[model samples]
Target: MILEIQNLHKVYNNGTHALKGVSFSVKEGEFLVVIGLSGSGKSTLLRSINRLIEPTSGTVRFLGKDITHIKGEELRKIKSQIGMVFQQFNLIKRRSVLSNVINGKLGSLGTFNSIIEKYSDEVYKEAYNCLDIVGIGDKAKVRSDSLSGGQQQRVAIARSLMQNPKLLLADEPVASLDPATSNSIMQYFERINKDFGTTVICNLHFLSLVRRYATRVIALKAGEIIYEGAPSDINEAWFKTIYGEEAEEVEIR
Candidate 1:
């Protein structure tokens, strides 16, 4: 297994219980999609995996190492191997697309190099390659804010790729996008998972996209896992169970 979360729990400072004893394992190269209504802990769960949000309790083991509380350089080292893409395309808006992509490697590059913006030729080459993978190499010189939302998201994906992450965590990556743009963005993720054998854990709202892109599905409700199975197995009964009795499935495509 690439990642193991055993009895993970996260209670916020405001006394909100975001994740309640959540546990799961992810094998290498699996496209794992997390589905749930808002406030159901999907984002919390993903963020906890990468230590972006510290778990209140429980263990998070990555590649056999328990990283729940490791600190300093050890924590930094672990973070370098895990890439994160947020709902908002969190790019440096004023910077060039290439510059934003290169920033992904800042964790690996020492403070001096990052401060000086002294990226090596190899770094530039890798950034370009990542942009190419997402079908936006030509936009390297463009200002990040100048690109359309879909293109900006592509840059975000490329930025994460520069980390050379073994595990990529996407938190509602397509939530801000339109239906067609959402599918296009998801296809890029699929390509990355397939071509690079990267493990992906994505939080999504749309069952249509989940069924189409996910190799496996896990549903959360009230900060708990209500269902875990194949996308096809999430039948009508399971849908209502996950989303609630009054909920209706919304198709994106």
Candidate 2:
């Protein structure tokens, strides 16, 4: 297993319990997708793996190591193995795409650098290679703000790839794009998972998108996982079971 989330629980300061004893395992190179409505804790689950949103309790293991117990330098070392992408591109708007992508190497770089633009040639080559993988090698010199939403998201994906991550976590990665662009971005993820054997875990609200891209689907509602199975096994009945009253509110494509 590349990622093991065991008996995880998270309770926010505002008295909202985001996760409730959720446990799951992600094998290396697997493409797993999580589906849920807004505020259903899907993002929380993904972020918890990177400790971006610390779990209130329970252990998260990455390749048999307990990351939950590791802190400070040890934790930073463990984090460098994971890469995350968000719905928002999260790129430095004023920076060139190459500059933003190079930021991925900061975790591995020593304190000798005062500025990120001074990234070593080796890291620069890696960033360029990642851009090529994402079909955006030509955009390396372009400022991030000049790119479209899909292009910007691709830059975000490239940024994650620059990290040489063992695992990729995408939180609503296509929510901001049109259907065609969303499909294109999803295809990129699928290709990356197939070609590079990068374990991919993504959160999405579109059932159709999940069916199209995910090998496995996990559904969450009210901080609880209501369904976990292959994408083909998902149906209206399963959606009803998970969404209940909200089933009518859900508009599946």
- Judged by TM-score, which candidate is best? 1
Q: What's model 1's overall lDDT?
A: 0.94
lDDT for position 235 in model 1: 93
lDDT of 2: 0.88
Which portions of model 2 show Cα errors greater than 4 Å? Answer: 114-116, 246-253
Candidate 2: count the clashes.
Answer: 0
TM-score of each: 0.99, 0.95
Instruction: Please provide, for model 2 over 148-219, each residue's C-alpha lDDT reduced to its tens digit, 9 standing for 90 to 100.
Output: 999999999998897788999999999999888988999999998999999999998777888888989889
Question: Mind giving the per-residue lDDT tens digits that candidate 1 earns over 3-74?
Answer: 999999999999999999999999999999999999999999998888888999999999999999888899
Superpose all Cα atoms of candidate 2 onto the true structure and report the RMSD in Å to 1 decimal.
Answer: 1.7
lDDT of candidates 1 onward, in order: 0.94, 0.88
Clashes of each: 0, 0
